[model samples]
Target: MNAATPLPTASARDTTAFLLDVLIPTAAKGPLMRRPRVEALAERLNLDRRAVTRMQKLEEKYPGGPLLLRLPIRKQAVVLLPEHLHAVLAGSPEPFSPASSEKRGALAHFQPRNVLISTGGERTARRALQEQALDTNSPVHRLASSFLPVVYEEADALLASIGDGDGATTDVLDWDLFITSWLRIIRRVIFGDGARDDNQLTDMLARLRKDANWSALKPQRRKTRDEFLRRVQSRINTAAPGSLASVMRGISEQDPAAPRDQVPQWLFAFDTSGTSAFRALALLSAHDEAAKKAREEIDADTTGGRNLPFLRATVLETVRLWPNTPMILRQTTTEVTWDNGTMPAKCGLLIFAPYFHRDGRRLPQADTFDPGIWLQDDVVDVGAREDWGLVPFSAGPASCPGRHLVLLLTSALLARLLQDTSFTLEGASRLSPSRPLPGSLDNFSLRFSPRPR
Candidate 1:
């Protein structure tokens, strides 16, 4: 793999010229906004205030499309362009490896060294196991379907706690608690009574629930999790007749190496399913018109039967708008020319999908919350699947293996929520966009009042 090209002798002047000639002019009145760094570049280039503000907003929304910010780090900078993202993600593995360490760093906050986050043998093994569990015909989906009642019961409990809204203002983060509860339900359904009964797994998950940022507590949390896994492994070793634990135990017995990474599997299932479901619910609540339309679509097609296309579209749209894994990174394995620039091998490329979702060229009135876009007859012809445009579950060989599972789980949960409750925004007010608690990943906390039937 090659490294980044060295800044030219006239690098400073070159950057200024690029900002003035290319970035500033194009960013004016664009559908999206630019990142703050772009505006900083404009100021450095002595651009006008109006031009800088317009450029900055475009960068913020669009990111890495209109301009490039070369960082001090060798071969490192942000590429804020869609075509660049397409080149990195959709390109061949020889030229751009998705499993690159630079790409792995993006997921470091979550699964630091799991299969999805790593390359080579570890990644291969993890993918095998995940594929086994995620297979459409696998018992896991059967178990998930069987556990719908339990999930519904858990949601009901959360609703009971909130008590008919009663004009009570509650942070939508409480909704996340409901999400965690359903995670436990899936756990019970998949792992059976023994794994569900395991106090250590429950306690460790409780710690994770309490500490929202579990990745930061790596040292302490790892120890607790390892201990829990050891206990679960021991229980699996002594399993009786038919059970989910027995199935896992059978896998371990069939392949003794399986136990070595079972904990990571459990963690992946818990974190991804719980986090994605919660974020989807939060977004649905925030976009009530979208929610209502989705609910109506569900009602119309399903006739309260099952597996409505409209419901599917709503989940797809939600993930598209606010993908949990919003950004994907890759490292160039070979020098490649893309989007009018040649990036040397080993250069780090970050592909931002959340920003990509707002690209006008991709979707009609891209910023608007419309689920109907996916249902359109010519969605593919309209370029929905082109490159990095519609990658909520990601793209290419290393894309999310749990795509079908996640879609099913999210759709089922959303269907139940819509069926059980009538929803509206609380206090006749909208949430402040400035709240930093949810962070830049995705803002998921939007208050809502549930009307009692």
Candidate 2:
């Protein structure tokens, strides 16, 4: 049965070949789990969008090939299709462990037991505490609401800093205005307004900008992280009453085992929002009708005191193109079963959301930016879905706890920004001959200015 299945690679000497020779097949030629290639696989996803185009090509080239594929190691199989994602993500955590070895190792120095990386009894407890800490009740909802002013202020500041005439020619990302301002929002969200001036928190965030090798080179990395976490933990009570920090502290008291430094994980979790927001900048600038419609919806919300569904739809569309984390890896503690296949114990699984969201056959207008696709025959419409098919924030028990909060924040910020300012893509960025996504995100440039009154 295994001989009938082919993976993305066929090199005889590759580790993938060895896995095939040594391990039993998961039904057909589906992905093989060997050692661990989580980090390497994540790197490919992070470094280039074109990598996704290539992976899609592989699946198309091999119609009967395994939906999952082994890279070089045995520990991970990139789950290429939607059904595979449902198998790993929708299943119970007992079989598909929530803690991926890659996440645990990568975040080891920053946080030893963040909810995302914790395992065993501690993992379950941490997850519970993490949820309580982010509960959508009054306090947590208030925390999210409180940040709107910050978003308004920062969005205005970003527009102000967009510079006039010649300066508008500058790269949008090069100035780092949005990055810095966005981090401030994440900081304020987690640590409260008192964190506005905390240099140590700022420094810790700076460390996250570099690669693992770069961090490994810094001799004081561990000490720096330890000191930062300790200081933050001690100051939880100092956070403003309605902020995420205070909520985390309250939960910590209830569950003595809950780590005080949990807020940092929340801070890190939204880092992808920064990128997603920027992509919105690029996309909205290109689609004037969409931008105009979104602005009108925002205006209506302002007048009618309603939520802006159009803006939310735009955010979902952006995420569909670029999921926060394209490849989510999970390791199996027990044998995991999916339709027609059984993954043995200790197998590592990958969930590729980017591919799933963009699959043309399943999703209407997969490549089209029709936020209207999200419109259901309901009272209110926003183009995102929490279904197994579209798992930007993923689905099931171990899925992201901050999904609601993130969607709320993302839509609100974009709505505010679009209402106040107008953007145009820089000529070079617009004309770049990138193979995949039209304008390369790395060099995307947008000129923001006040809209006509």
Candidate 3:
């Protein structure tokens, strides 16, 4: 059969199940993922596992499917096979556009001109500008020397604030405490040391992001957005020597590339990366071998830069095990031909990462924590080739421009925390190595107590 072959259309019952069990819960979590109540409920219900099982059954019903899901307003295609996923991602910005209608709607609230929501020559220019500023090609960014100390300083403050003055063995830590320190690091790294205490700025962005959760359905908060942008521009104007804002300022300006406009996305992305860092710590606490290896890498790196490869790999593994962006959405810019069938123009494509990441049928170490998979060249650069279907950062040309930089900061922070302390996962019963890790790691409820190693 050619691309026009009749594909398996989801039954009405299954369609409702997909919406309730997958899409609704995901959307409810908020694009910012700030809804703790929803997160806890999803974890207790094991929602991701339910979604995975549903997709698994569908795959069995129609092998190597291009499953047609009937949405209320439009039809969507779910990529069941790895090859189909590869094809859609690889042919992006043309046949398959990453700037899907839904994405444009969500990002428009905060970063309308950001590269993720742009296309054509404008996307190219903006992407090039961002890649240059972020040093996307390098594992350690050009400004790592300046950035490393900021990480260490903030990490130290975090440790000190959480520590008992009496030098007690363990210090209790949770999401609120960790995120407070993490945001400090993010502000300092992205803006400058001057922005270290800018709670008002981040708070404003948070309010805007909440509206963003509703996408275009929510009317634009022009007043709030304008103030947020003004404050962001003020921070950028400082251009402190070591920060990303400084680097962006130094980069040659390109037409239609509004550097300040991209700040919201960076701030937003760093929020998730911060969560990933905490989850990596949780993973380390639960798995002794991985923890030991991570410690060894930390010890071996005497540079104080803390840019350790294994640490980065640990972050990658955490993301793979529990992706922050669960469902990667793409829209067809033009009618596209697939192995099973042809999807009409503007059809949304859904590639649910948890299914592929934890699919035991394909990956032997799927359910286990294995950072070593990322250490391999073939796997690290899988975007250009046929992937094993592990896309924690999303692959291909449209992959995150800040991948290397985010990993660097996150890995450094993780390394700093693990250097002189031992952490025990509190109340994380499902994270042990002896069994399959839970599908949903409720990062909000995740708590850890640090002890002297």
Candidate 4:
């Protein structure tokens, strides 16, 4: 066979630009949602749009190969092809590992033993515990009955707090209004009703995640991390009935699962889910067709259950449009052979999700509001023959274990909001179905006005 094509390394200037422009801004945006000012700056500068454009230009210059970034100490590969992205993501914990150095440094701030950063027998055991607790194999969680009610009740309270009238007067809903209510729901679902007001738990986690945004550069907040774990342990020990903590009770304490260590990741993931939920509301409010479809789905179901596929798809599209996890990084445990060339073991691979999800060049539906794509069976699976172009949740073995539960809660909340109320976008990020959507949506500034029925 002919020798594989050589991996094209970027110039030193390109490497510096990537770090300064793409990576730093994403980090500055915060690991969790603490940095609203940075979020506003990102949105104002159209940072994501600019980053995607840069990736596209680099890919065009070095077609059909992963672009190599020559850093000071080690090299990393930036994936250009969709097939490559799918393969690398799906082939996790093998030649390709999810526990990249950067990921390890970041997550170790809070969840040192998280499955994403685990290896060998430890990974196997911890993953099983997580999947069992999360109902990872199911489309809807096993505890859906228990979880859906929490969503509906909190959503109802939020609507009531907004203002219950003949629907004539408009009430403005923004991040503070929505997320405050959403976090209460998250705490109730994950920890129990007793922990519903436990803002300190989430706040401690936020501090660790802020330090995590610096990756290994920032010193570990040992005191804060320990206290955060203690708080998480307290909630888990309570195991209040009908909560995810309760579900985790089935696992034995001797399994070396590090169960308390896992809760921070859940808290962190759900924080991003809240952002996606807010953004979904914005998109539904702005795009008429999607809003109509979501409403139809809500109206078609009488049981008030969690089967809002269109609404779920809308959440997927919202993440796809403005990905919560923009940079998906992986480290190779063994040398990886690409179609173009072989990368050495321990090399990092960067899959800039925004580039793949919104590259207008590759995706015809890229720049518009289209949840319909997710309606199809397009999600690439491990060892599957098909390749996926868009990845909102990183696919394969290391995909978000809480995906179903997150979607269930998110879609259910969307259903509740859309059922009795109609909302309109109230800010500069208002989207129109006829036009290409803006690259950066400031979820913090995303405002909605509820109109009369």
- lDDT on C-alpha atoms for all candidate structures: 0.50, 0.58, 0.82, 0.81
Candidate 1's displacement at residue 156, Å, is 3.3
Candidate 4 structure quality by residue, lDDT tens digits, 180-276: 8899998999988898899999888887888888788889989988888878887888868878888666555456787877777888888889999
Clash number for each model: 18, 10, 0, 1
For 1-453, candidate 2 gives per-residue lDDT tens digits of: 243332343233433442432222211111211111432333234433344454466566544223344454554555656665675676647677767665565555566667767767777787777777676322124455576776677666666555563435333433256767787777777777777656567567446433222223323367777776777786686778767777666555446345664666676667667767777766777777788887787777752212556766676667776566655678889755444354556667666565677666566556556666555652223322545367666667777777656666777777766776666665433422232343124322343434433
Winner on lDDT (1 vs 3): 3
Question: How far out, in Å, is residue 242 in model 2?
Answer: 1.4
Query: Ten consecutive residues with minimal summed lDDT in candidate 4?
Result: 378-387
In the range 212-327, model 1's lDDT, one tens digit per residue, is 23223333455665565565567666544433344455564335235434444454444455555655555566666767776775566533323455555666666675455544
Q: Estimate each model's TM-score.
A: 0.67, 0.78, 0.94, 0.93
On lDDT, the stronger of 2 and 3 is 3
Task: Supply candidate 1's per-residue lDDT for 366.
Answer: 51
What are the clashing pairs of model 3?
none
Q: In model 1, what lDDT does residue 72 have? A: 60
TM-score of 2: 0.78
Full ranking by lDDT? 3, 4, 2, 1
